[model samples]
Target: MKRTWFTHPEPLDTTTANELIQRYTSRQIQTKKTLAFDPKFWLVSALLPEYRHEPKPSKQYQNSIWSQ
Candidate 1:
């Protein structure tokens, strides 16, 4: 099945985005009971000015943290 986020181009409203962010930060998956990673953490954090800090690791770093 195609992902809604991919099939649709509209960005989520602030309220929805914040809810998703909170769910991720708290490690509470509202959609399902199983724990899963949320890629939106970085995306939403980046849009907010207060979330300043070192950026998330790149794909290369994610693949091999010890190599570089």
Candidate 2:
């Protein structure tokens, strides 16, 4: 954890890490059913990038309303 992006005031020991993971896992269990069956979920996200080609933004795009 040395030279990482974030600096924690906390000392992250094994027990604290396990507790954090359990909290996250509990949240996912509550939301998993809804996200898994949604049409605009991971499947479309994964496939769209492969099948669709998008134009790269030019310098002019910086001032365009679309950028906003």
Q: Which candidate should be chosen as best, given lDDT against the real structure? A: 1
What tens digits encode model 2's per-residue C-alpha lDDT throughout 1-68?
12212222343444554465466456552111112233333211110122244577579537677667
- CA lDDT, every prediction? 0.41, 0.35
Per-prediction TM-score? 0.28, 0.27
Which 10-residue window in model 2 sums to the lowest lDDT?
42-51
Report the error of model 2 at residue 60, Å: 44
lDDT of 1 by residue, 1-68 (tens): 22222111234554666676677557642231212245332233322223445678667535465658
TM-score of 1: 0.28
In model 1, which runs have C-alpha deviations exceeding 4 angstroms? 1-10, 28-68
Best by TM-score: 1
